[model samples]
Target: MDEVVRRDVEHAHGDTRMISALAAPRRTSAGPAVLLLHDAFGLSDDMLRIAHDLARLGFPVLAADVWGDRTLPTTQEEIGPLIGSMVSNRSRWTARLDAALAAAADQPEVDPEQVVALGYCFGGSSALELLRTGGRLRGAVSIHGGLDLLEPDADWSAADPEAHVLVCTGADDPMATAEHRAALESGLRRAGVDWEIDLYSDTRHAFTSPHAKNSPTPDAVAYHPRSAARSWAATTRFLTELFPTVRPVEH
Candidate 1:
């Protein structure tokens, strides 16, 4: 695969503290855009790699940062509190996400009308939240992320008619339990949204992160290459179906 272009950018919400990364296929003209939301770990090399992968598939991508300048938590013990802090300030988090989506759509290389929001872990929930806001998005994809609905009675009446959703998860992931899945399904169904959830067997949380294997709690969160590849394949197909103008690169 060819190298994609990448650059750092700052997105100003009410606080102007978040920094984002933009990546896309080299030498390509304007194309569909993807607002890539990072996991609870915040922006990292793994997330950037995912952006590049999407760019190579003919979609411009922007990796949004939700954690501002806060240092990323390296250990499991620290991750809980860091995530809790963001969860406590859900309004601010949602604002930052909205800003990131706006910034991505405003990019010159992006076709704003054909934008999608794709996220992992905590970001997965953020993607769903974006949908709940009735943003002008073509679709949303959640990869092994939390499935809790922020608004049970959210009004999806203003959502884009073409809006689609895909949730990929590990069946054994304790964080994303059966209860969460059931609740998410009920909400989507009530909203009359088009959605699908693919559960991978024998996979745990963070299956898409190559560095998950190095985590202290490997049993709870480890990389599953097979699951990752399958989920990514599903994403590409979903994107292609949603935006027929952008064809995915054949591997």
Candidate 2:
């Protein structure tokens, strides 16, 4: 994995400037691209490790960063303020996501027409928001991400009808409440998107992250080996369906 600079993304609500993730594919690709978004912890080591896993599966992956060059948040207590501010100011993340996709498409290793976005934890929510904001993806996969509406009452008519969506959720996640799931379901259904969901039983938030237990509430963020394995399989399956040419190397 190497740090290749992605173009500066435009973001600002009350003076926040453009931020770069210093992120790129863990390895240069000879196939399609996946734009990977990080969680509230920012582009931490765990997130980069996950990006590497995806890269090994035969895709050039661009790790997306919303917070511009700021110190990475450690504990949930430290993360709360940064994530809270970004969520409350939805424009910040939406713009950041857009720029990440644009940057991914521009990379020489990427097939501009074959780009998809994948997110983990907070990134999962951003992936969905990219759809809500009309991001033109071949497909999207959200692994244990929040389901709340980023912009309640926002129009969905502009969303890309060609993009299919896969949502992998921990059924018991407090962060992904019933209300948020309902809103996501209704919005996606109303938008006429082709989508699927893997509701992992007894799972909680950040099921794919070993570092999830580092959060203040361990149980709420505990990792589930079963769900993690299954969700990753689901993600690869979804990607295959969208791009039959997507050749995933043996794990």
Candidate 3:
């Protein structure tokens, strides 16, 4: 597989800021576009690997750095203060996601109408938040994200009724509790949204990452290889089904 160099994208609001993106153009040019959002730890090498893997599946994948040249917190001690301060402020976070999508859609190799958003960890949760604002995304996949079904202002009427959704999470992830999963499913059912949720038994957060390690205590983090592989396969199937034009290309 060929790798494309990272390009500078201007993220806008009142000020213009630049972010790096990795784009892999498809050989056929007829496939859909997939936007890969990295976890809160930021755009590490593993995220780039995932982008390449998705691109090899026949879609033009864009891996965006939502942090946008900013320093990301690495240790567990730093995560709480950083995310806790930013989580509730959806406006700032979703703007970053929106900018990434807008830039991806503008690419010559991308089909704007056939864009799919897939996120990992913090990104996974943000992908769903993007949906709340009524973006042009055709589908969304959340992988082991911290999800809550308590959107008081979610206008189910305005959402794309046919839009597909995939939630691939770990059964043992403390962040994604069974109650929350059930609530999400119930909310989707009530809204008549087309969605599927798969839980991997014994898998913790960030299972897909090879560097995944389990937390020793009840509130720590852990990863499961089996769960990660299975969830990835499920995500591939879901994306292919949603966008029939994109087919998996063996590497």
Q: Model-by-model lDDT, in order?
A: 0.81, 0.74, 0.72
In model 3, what is the error at residue 55, expressed in angstroms? 0.9
Q: Where does model 3 exceed 4 Å of error?
A: 1-10, 13-18, 26-30, 148-155, 214-219, 248-251
- Candidate numbers, best TM-score first, in rank order: 1, 3, 2
Candidate RMSDs in Å, in order, are 2.7, 3.9, 2.7
Q: If scored against the real structure, what TM-score would every candidate get?
A: 0.89, 0.84, 0.86
Q: In candidate 2, what are the lDDT values of residues 1-251, reduced to their tens digit?
A: 23332333344323544343333433445457788888777777777776666666667777766665645787768888877876887776677778778867766667878878888888898888887888878777898887653555666776788778899988898878777777777777888888888889999998888776555676687888999999989988887777676554443
Superposed by TM-score, candidate 2 places the C-alpha of residue 83 at a distance from the truth, in angstroms, of 1.2
Regarding TM-score, does 2 or 3 come out ahead? 3
Please, what are the lDDT tens digits per residue for candidate 3 over residues 1-251? Answer: 44443454555533536364655644546458788888877767788788777767777877777766644557768666556645666676667778888888877778888888898988787777666566678888899877752353454554466677899988878778888787677666666679889988777777776546644553436767778888888988988787777665654
> Scored by Cα lDDT, where does model 1 land?
0.81
Question: Model 1 compared with the native: what TM-score?
Answer: 0.89
- In model 1, the Cα lDDT at residue 144 comes to 91
